[model samples]
Target: MGYNGPLNNAKYLKACFTKPYKFFIHSVVHTVSHRKGGCDVMKDYQICMVTALVLNKKYNFSIIVFHYMKENITSKSRILVYLRFV
Candidate 1:
């Protein structure tokens, strides 16, 4: 949810420098979390929450973060855009 330091700075940096792996961790984690959803209920919740946190950090876009990033964007506009994209 918040800006924590890299999970594995070395690996992350390597991923950033390498091809196809710039977003490798995020992609793999997302797939794994989605697959886990069908197996265990509590684990699924944990995976979903963690995945949301990872995505929030990687994209730097979440409701809370978005307000901090663009103070000028109105909540109504934000909701409208989100709905439209969905």
Candidate 2:
């Protein structure tokens, strides 16, 4: 399965922060997408996690977002439902 769609804006944002690290964004998405039992929301969440790590590394934003995600998204079903609106 090839990803022909335009790169997500998050990829650009990651590039802006650290050019060297941008390459992982698409690879991570691609790798996760190819893995069995993963869904669209999980892929999206992985993107979000990558972005968050980039932002946290550059801007040092409070890690509350990570904690919040971990606490709220306790199950695969919950992640699927929550990320649908995110």
Candidate 3:
């Protein structure tokens, strides 16, 4: 069954990732939720992931790109720091 409701709703999230998508979805959700904040983090992550999934489905975008970009920004900042020290 496909879900078309608000992702922040635990019921929808639970229903949406029942079979094949369960492990991957749960891992991503847990990783994102814990990495971002403490309270209400899961809800925030649900909204973000829903937007990302929708955009991915509609525009053929890769969510991995967001991960890459985040890493890239961190690496760039580290490089800048190294340059400043040199």
Alpha-carbon local distance difference test for all models? 0.36, 0.44, 0.45
Count of clashes, each model: 0, 0, 0
Q: Show the lowest summed lDDT stretch of 10 residues, model 3.
A: 77-86
Ranking by TM-score: 3, 2, 1
> Which of candidates 2 and 3 reaches a greater TM-score?
3
Report the lDDT tens digits of candidate 2 across residue range 1-86: 22334466332333333445546664554443433343332334565656676566543323534444555567555543222212
Error of 1 at 31 (Å): 23
Best-to-worst ranking by lDDT: 3, 2, 1
Per-residue lDDT over 18-62 for candidate 3, one digit per residue giving the tens place of the 0 to 100 score: 365555555555544423334222454354565567467553224
lDDT of 2 at 19: 45
TM of each candidate vs. truth? 0.19, 0.27, 0.33
User: Which candidate number maximizes lDDT?
Assistant: 3
Clashing pairs in 2: none
Clashing pairs in 3: none
RMSD (Å) of each candidate, 1 decimal: 13.4, 9.6, 9.4
Shift of residue 76 alpha carbon in model 2, Å? 15
Instruction: Using lDDT as the measure, name the better of candidate 1 and candidate 2.
Output: 2
